[model samples]
Target: MSADAVRYLVMPNPYLSDGVLDVRAVQPADIEAIRQWRNAQMDVLRQTAPISPEQQERYFAEHVWPQITSLEPSQVLVALERAGVLIGYGGLVHISWSNRRAEVSFLLTPELEKNTDELIALFSRFLDLMKQLAFEDLGLRRLCTETFEHRTRHVATLEASGFRCEGRLREHVLIDGKPTDSFTHGLLAVEWKNGQ
Candidate 1:
């Protein structure tokens, strides 16, 4: 769909916290940190190259800021923070308002990936909050994610959060000059409500 055609209902309040991690709207100050993290984790992301400061600035001004201000946005990006420090960022991207569905996109500071236990804890908690935002606050019926098959730990976390494996795309993407398979996962509001 054309960028201009996408619509989203404005969230009354985009801040969410569980007495620890806080998920709030992405702001100007977050773009640089987000760019760095995305660049460092390109192997696990769809982005092929590092984002330039200029490009990041333009993106925030043209695409992201509009979403923050618009009543209807194509995406809902947020900054993940802990004790007022930025840890990561992500949100419901590729949202289809009519279908009430969106793709889950999340990432953390590159350093955190080195610690398995902390990674799982933060990721799992983040997923929980995203679920609340997607299925509860936004009234979306479905949420989905695409993960590279090699990310076993990440995939396990998704499954633990109630997302079921919908399918796997064989050799779906190129990673380090080799074909890599990706798994698609989905979670419905009904299923989430039932604790499935």
Candidate 2:
């Protein structure tokens, strides 16, 4: 689809909510919180070092803001909020309009990671919202995500949300000096619709 077409589909409003949770465009104020969450959870993220304030600002300016304003953005990110409080952020990243696919990117506040049940519920809801945007709103064919194998809870959440484990990348990354495997999961638009 053309960039303008995509934008038009979601024009005027892009905020998505499921009564309790709200997923809206990332604003300038969200950068610091996002950076903190990412840095605190570096063990599960691809980032190797903490993001300095300047670096985060530059990234928001050069990368994030443009994605929000650009007609053909490679990513469509959003901040996750509950009752007006920021809880997390994620979105359809690495978008391929030609293929009608995009990789899911999600992260919650590190504090929430301690409660497995709550985490699962929140993640599942987030996935549903993401599917709505990807399939119904943007006409995407598929959505995918990759996570370290150690994140078993997260993997289970993906499974519960109907994403199938497609493959495993053995020793794909290093965490705490040990090589770790990663799993990739995918959900087709047809599958999402049928499940609903």
lDDT of each: 0.87, 0.87
Candidate 2 residue 1 C-alpha distance from true site, Å: 28
lDDT (C-alpha) at residue 24 in model 2: 82
Give TM-scores for every candidate, taking all chains together and pairing residue i with residue i: 0.93, 0.93
Model 2's number of clashes is 0
lDDT of 1 by residue, 1-196 (tens): 1344322347655578888899887767778989889889999999998899999999888887777656557899888899989999998899999999999998999898878898889889999998998888889999999999988889999999899999999999999999999999999999999984
Query: At residue 57, what lDDT does model 2 achieve?
Result: 98
Candidate 2 weakest lDDT stretch, 10 residues: 1-10
Per-residue lDDT of 181 in model 1:
99
